[model samples]
Target: MGSSCGPTGPEPGAAAERVIYLDNAATSWPKPPEVLAAVQHYLLEVGANPGRAGHFRAAEAGRLVFRARRAVADLLGLHNPMRVVFGANATWGLNQAIAGLLRDGDHAVTTTLEHNSVLRPLHRLQEEGRITLTVVRAAGDGYLDPDEVRRAVQPGRTALVAVTAASNVCGTIQPVAEIAARCRTLGVPLLVDAAQAAGAVDLDLARDGIDLLAFAGHKGLLGPTGTGGLVLADDFDAARLRPLTVGGTGSRSDSVRQPDFLPDVLESGTLNVAGLAGLAAGIDWLHGPGGGPEAVGRHELGLRRRFIDQATARVEGFQVAGNPAGPAVGVVSFTVEGLSPSDLGQGLAREFGVLGRQGLHCAPLAHETLGTFPVGTLRFGFGPFNTAGQVDLAVAALAEICRQERP
Candidate 1:
């Protein structure tokens, strides 16, 4: 599994002295060196917009962007790279898919485990009287039943079914394949938000029967922020979806009508080319020569297991939000009996240099589903860069934080 792209931990220093970044779910830090180098090269040597002009540099930039698109498509199990439409992030992609496809009188189905990225847009549409919405609730363990989703879908009435592949707050991996199977049989398109599952879970859009997928580059994909997109299945029709934004696509110069093409229709205006370059490097690093997602997933899981084992055994008042063990991703979230999440998170950051997420993590219903609303749990999103030593130090810090009384 050794490769130049493998995560390299912090340099030698006291455990408390170094910043133990545990908020990988927000955005990954200490990005792979290859990602940094690729970005620098793009900004310095190849400084031109893709598809904007016919110059040599522009053509090369376009080529670089296409390479990234291909990498993303392959990673997500798509046969055609052109189906990957770049966007600002998973939120943007979700809005495009949810808002664009659902028309008047259309009905949409979703789950409680989804982040606000999915909920907000769908709610907005519901409020506007454009679409009818059905949100299925998950169990306390954060698992959504595929049959529940099947029951929610109305044949020829449900336009789309949206669900999360993994919960950002609880790290539960939903039964997307089974859900997709039901949707396929009922003639409904399934859109999965893979923000937390892209690089951490085994997702094959074709095999899983997923119609559309939204992913974040910075979270599980280990790419730079401001990089992410929507991936369409080979058989899915891109024409059904409308553009979220439209501007200079550098195509169809004669007319102002938005070019109705695979990428040009959805991807308008200039893209973050430098960021895309870095994203390409990140994707290549994961699949080119290293052990890929399997190696990384195992590493993060080991770190999660280490933290849970140490924290629950050595510390008091440590209760995780969901089932401690399950078919899920690498995120672990817990609440302390004597301490509030904000208080504990502040103590970890100020006293021990351990940074983690607190509160509902922008997933209010997810916390409500877990019965942890109003007051949420402290979350530690394990990543490939995190080590067991760091987890040990974090556990020790948590013990100290719990020992102290409330203010």
Candidate 2:
């Protein structure tokens, strides 16, 4: 962070293997040592269901869960940890927020730069005639206009406005804060899919006026795959929303009904306590000596810039999707002439040990917004653990792939 952090050697916790990992958008790899240790400690020492029993191990597990909930809340700028609901993944969080909040005949607004997590739920609701949906289009570069979002929200009818903080495909960080401000002015609830933006960019849910923030632990938080949740704004009323699931919360043992509380309302049954232990350690590691989000952002963006410049200059017929001249996360989608995305991605991995994702990357609408529909671009997602030298090697592999394609 103090230096350019240019990779003269392997990144922290990185392996010596030649297989380079670049698909960080789906899930980060080589998690910090602390995360792994936390998980192991939980499994070995505190193997109990949190808030389920009066046993000491269960209490300890409950404490671990609370710490993780608080850390996640603090990460998003919320003071109340109970406002955060831990679930299986960001998709679960999004589904809970969308399905639990909107009622029959209610209308919602979203953008084209959305992952299927947000899209499928809303589409299902629309198909079921439960809610009316309005999808706002983003620019070719995947930038969504806050004014366009405001125009889409029908003052009293629009119950929720769901949008991704960044594009999972091209790494375009949307003006979510601006959209939040607009939603606030219009008295509408805003749910942000922070699967991509959580650790890649700075997010202040309270400061940004975001009512509900859904994020994944595995992707940006560097936690285990089963950990993620939704955070409710401090002043937001929980009574306005309902739980998608209702069963034993371990607190409402005396009553058959779900507990009418912040976390218990949404979080039903057993949670991923082991995964949450990893998430807690991951958050601390992220903001500790390893690097905060700003440092991580700088490192990844610099790597992205390096790859883009080198690939454009050295590889013939290399083309990148989206506008490359703005503040963005590390995900970059590109194509080479005379090659399909899957072929190039496979070639890069098979021939040179470079790993990256090909195809829509679960964001077909994002690909369509960038005009890379049906067929997709090979995507490289740089992470905080990535290095400049790694990008250089990947770009060289890409150049070679293009070279073979040319002949």
Q: Which candidate is the best by TM-score?
A: 2
Off by over 4 Å in 2: 1-3, 6-16
For candidate 2, lDDT tens digit of each residue in 180-275? 999999999999999998887899988899999899999888899999988999999998878888887888699888889989988898999989
Most lDDT-accurate candidate: 2
Could you give candidate 1's per-residue lDDT for residues 1-407 as a string of tens digits?
A: 12233444433245424788899888876667788888998899999999888899999899889988999988878899999999989998999999889999999999999999999999999999999999999999999999999999988889999999999998878899999999999999999999998887889999999999999988877789999989999999999998899988999988889999889899998999988998898877776433587667767777777788899898877898987888767798899886889999999998999999999999999999998998998999987677777788999988888787444
Worst 10-residue stretch by lDDT in candidate 1? Answer: 1-10
Query: Against the hidden true structure, what lDDT does model 1 obtain?
Result: 0.87
